[model samples]
Target: MLYQDHTSVVCKKQIFHTEFILRCHYYITTFDLYYTDQIQQTT
Candidate 1:
């Protein structure tokens, strides 16, 4: 029973880590696009 609980905790951690990475990637991509648009407008 303890082992099963540990496995479940690990799985949850993995899911959370994956979600965090994806969110960071989305934010970075959005920022990059916005930055490019701003630069283009200035020139």
Candidate 2:
């Protein structure tokens, strides 16, 4: 029972980390695209 609980906690932690990384990546990509578009328009 203790092992199962520990495993569950680890799984949750992994999922949270994965989600955080994905969100950060998405925001960076979106910002880069927006900046690029603005630059193109100005030029």
Candidate 3:
């Protein structure tokens, strides 16, 4: 849960601060993404 929160926060900050959010769209599945925190995965 904590790691997920951190990833989310980082994701938000990355978009707010830099151009690193573009390459994130190639993620077809949540499991395949860079912020791949499986502890909070949903069905």
Candidate 4:
């Protein structure tokens, strides 16, 4: 039972980390798009 609980905790941690990474990637992409648009408008 203890082992199962530990496994579950590890799984949850991994999921959280994955989600955080994805969010960061999305924000970075969004920022890049915004910058590109700005440059295009200026040009």
lDDT of each: 1.00, 1.00, 0.66, 1.00
The TM-score that candidate 2 achieves is: 0.90
TM-score of each prediction? 0.96, 0.90, 0.40, 0.90
Give the Cα error of residue 41 in candidate 3, in Å: 60
Looking at model 3, residue 24 earns an lDDT score of 54
lDDT of model 3 at position 31? 44
Extract clashing residue pairs from model 3.
none
Q: For candidate 3, give the lDDT.
A: 0.66
Q: Give the per-residue lDDT of model 1 (tens digit) for 1-43.
A: 9999999999999999999999999999999999999999999
Clashing pairs in 4: none
lDDT of 3 at 5: 100
Where model 1 places Cα greater than 4 Å from the true spot, the runs are none
Residue runs of model 4 more than 4 Å from their true location after superposition: none
Q: Which runs in model 3 stand beyond 4 Å of their true positions?
A: 19-43
After TM-score superposition, the amount by which residue 17's alpha carbon in candidate 2 deviates from its true location, in angstroms, is: 0.6
lDDT of 2 at 10: 100
All models, RMSD in angstroms: 0.4, 0.7, 16.1, 0.7
Model 1 scores worst on lDDT over the 10 consecutive residues at 1-10
Clashes of each: 0, 0, 0, 0
> Model 3 misses residue 33 by how many Å?
39
lDDT, model 3, position 28: 46
Model number with the top TM-score: 1
lDDT digits (tens) for residues 1-43 of candidate 2:
9999999999999999999999999999999999999999999
Instruction: State the TM-score for model 1.
Output: 0.96
